[model samples]
Target chain A: MTTNSSDFGPTNPPASMNSVGPPAGVPDSAAFRSAGPPARMPDPAVVPPTGQSAGPGAESEPAVSLQGVTKRYGDKYAIRDMNLKLPRGRVVGVLGPNGSGKSTMFRMLMGLSRPDVGEVKVLGRNPGWEANGSIAYLPDRARWYADHTVMRAFTWAQSLLPGFNLDSALRLAKFMNIDLDMRASAMSRGQEARLMLILCIARSVPLFLLDEPFSGIDVMSRERIIEGLIEHMSESERTVLISTHEIQEAESLFDTVVFLQDGGVVLAGDADELRAEYGSMYATMQKLYRG
Target chain B: MTTNDWQVEPARPPGMFWALIRHDIKLRRRRGVVLPRRWRMAYAIAAFVILMVSVTLEGPKAHFYLNAVWYFTFGYPFMTLGISAGRIKREWRNGTSGWWMSLSMPRWQLVLAKAISSFIRALMIYAGTYLAVSILGAYTLVLRGTFNAQTMGQFLLQGLEWNGLLVGAAPFMIAFGVLLAILSSSSARPLAPLMWVVIGGLWWGIFPIAGASNWFAVHGSGQSAAITITPAVFPAIFGSWVLASICLFLSIYLMRRFVDISQA
Candidate 1:
């Protein structure tokens, strides 16, 4: 296991549609290609045949739960029949292809859309319950009032949302070096991302959902955003769910990784356990996906 | 586990309505455009001069001035709707609905708060015009020496009717404005209010041409009129209210079901 850490290397891979060149550990070229793709056998230990998950409090309740979640637009299925349960207080990563319903799931959880069938819950409440200051969601594309300054945006948040605290927001603004009085439309993408993070973190809400938080930012800004996220996570009751394809940059931050294909969960488990079960995480993942 | 899977009790009660209003005001101040003080002062002066001119021209003296006050009463409610449209459109164009959604106040509460605020603003505008008219009326009465108990009573009755008309319509107007805010996301929204006004005007205009514009016909006291309610005065008032209620209901439903802050 000493060399196990080196198996996943440092080149930040773009998670956008197999856009990341193979990072490391796997054969870089055609020479060491496997004869056949790897098969994913169900792990008997993880899934008890009884079909009953360990209930709440014995282990904390799943931060999210879905049974038969399906999203369809007219005749086409945007997402189909997904069942999942994510436990509370862990950093869970959601990875999927572009059309794989990642945004749909997040939107449903945030009460933006209704699932055609089954039920979904966040922080033990249906999506509508999130209105009671329990969940903080950062969207893939963050937008603010055009005429609103960073300070004004924070003030607006503080006034309308019970969870938002201006003092914490200002501290975050100062730390990020954002000019509070500048209009939001004038901000660079990196600054907007950071501001979104700042607003989300300043809230006292227990569950945080970040959808594609690190896209289109320079390396230095990304690093700073990551650091702020870590700082925000310092509280024990906080649970963070980040959806991103940039596995290499964010892999270290996640305690668990979930892979969604075609609106169904293909793989989910403790990251460490997965690495131990298979010699290489990325290599095994790629092979399994290919198959 | 089948029927009653995982149910979370609603965590908070419907709080005081004022809390939502206060929050909304903060949001407006933060995200909204503030009319410059100088422009506001200039507008006030211009309105004052216009009211004076209309009163002089009408010559019924009290009646003419009352007409001016009536027009002024409509201004506040109209401005409430118009300005809200502008604010919401700006938010949509800039893509800020995501941030707005994260606030998580129940949709109904937000709607109710907005209605109350708009109503209150309408009252203020009416009050300003009421005072100005009252002053003008009193001075004109003093100058003519014809001021009497009957005239004062008439003024009181007219005031009651006018104020009642605005107050009754305030909720519908607020609801209509908020719906406009929601629907403004569609590109075809700018014409909505204009269409409403034009339709109303056409209805009233045609009624006069058809000879149904007389007072008896308007109050529903006459049956022999040619075009009783075709495109004119009757349907415009009640129709707008009905349409506004439906649109408001739709906006509330979408805010509750389809408003996703996570997309922000």
Candidate 2:
């Protein structure tokens, strides 16, 4: 087990100062120990049978859960024995560098790729089954048909996905300055990014998995896109998991944050709580990553 | 907010299937013509001119009609295979298959839709060519004062037989092409050449190994050769249908189990 000692800094801090100091309620080391290692965390000894209810106090199950999940390619581990639980009605930022298994995790959640071992559940059901309908995913790469116009794509989404809202999609596209008549193949990289965002945000699904949503767009456009996303998110009981490397730009949108390093979660907790402990979210993330 | 409030309504299979079919058609239409408009017009005009010249010169004979039957028998399937293979190659090249998978529809439905769309496309092209040739052939026969009930009935029957065989063999060819596209490594590059090579090798390897080389040689000789309607013909037709069904099932299985959108 690899313990990240730097994450065991604070539980409760003083009312005035914001620093990496020990706090009340739980011990600093105890929190890290309870959560187990960043990778290969031990699986739950007692797994309830399918269709059976979880134990007492576990009535509100997570929107997305992975227990002892490991995915490998050749001899290299993309992600290994990583356990994660994302609650509903929150925007959790999965901050990681390139090749940190962020996209792999998103693929597993969407059932675009399967894990080599262990269980992956989305909305209390296995992914790639009925759960696929409930999860609206925007992958890291552009997957739209090249010949389709924006309006055509919207029409297709409306036809295929029960949760898609054409009016909202058009509204979002208008806000993004994306022309409804422009061919998808003719669009620039930034325009394609905006188009994908509109497609994902217009869906009223339970879980939204966005992998690198703002990769190619400029900072100014990304801000606008993020604003549009936030407006739509406010109208629904949705859980969003955005895997991105642009931490400073998107930090304000996160209710909770998980910092992944080398395909392992090094630090994770509530954004404000970490902010209170380390003065700022950036500061906390920088400290954890650098350590 | 409650989790129930966020739950998405399940997508109906029938609705999803139709949507996929619609999307595939729209994609094909947007890609426009395989042959340019002027070229297609030129070909049609040339075909008409050739028919007129032939009728004005040598007149229509039974051999001319037999040649038409031969062309329909051998040429149609090869054309259909080429068109179906092109459809798969285009989908992979343009990333349309990946986009389709990202939708709410099941993977099997997506594969089935592709197969159906490919068949539809191939049938359209084959039907167009057949009608053009048949109309010209009939006109020549009419000019020669040979358009009798018996002759017309024979022509129609032969046309039906050729079309039936083509239709029976279409599903297998389409499914095989789609499977190759799904299993291909590169998204930007066309897999048709490699697929053709592999398929050609298999056909060559199977005929002699199955001791069917004599059967092939007889059928492949020419329209002038004496044709025999043996018991093997029925079994061959039945085998083609079975192979088509198996290929379709295998394509769907490979799509659901192994194909990944990210790879495409």
Record all residue pairs in model 1 with backbone atoms less than 3 Å apart, i.e. clashing. Answer: A15-A245, A141-B264, B203-B231, B203-B232
Interface RMSD (Å), each candidate?
7.2, 3.9
**What lDDT tens digits, residue by residue, belong to model 1 across residues A1-291?**
111113222243223212212322222223124323211111110111111233344134567877677887657676677667676656777776666678788878877667889788786677863443677788766665555689877866666555677888897788778898887667888888888888888877667888888878877788888887777666444557888766666666776666766666655667666566554456535644554
Best by TM-score: 2
What are the fnat scores of the candidates, in the order listed? 0.32, 0.35
Structure candidate 2, residue pairs in collision: none
Q: lDDT by residue for model 2 over B155-242, one digit each (tens)?
A: 5555665566567667667767666666563332264477679778866774574356233223333332433333444566577668
**Full-model lDDT for every candidate:** 0.59, 0.65
Considering just the first chain, candidate 1 attains a TM-score of 0.77
DockQ of each: 0.23, 0.29
Q: What would the per-residue lDDT of candidate 2 be over residues A249-270, giving only the tens digit for each residue? A: 7888887677675655555667
Total residue pair clashes for candidate 1: 4
What's each prediction's TM-score? 0.65, 0.76
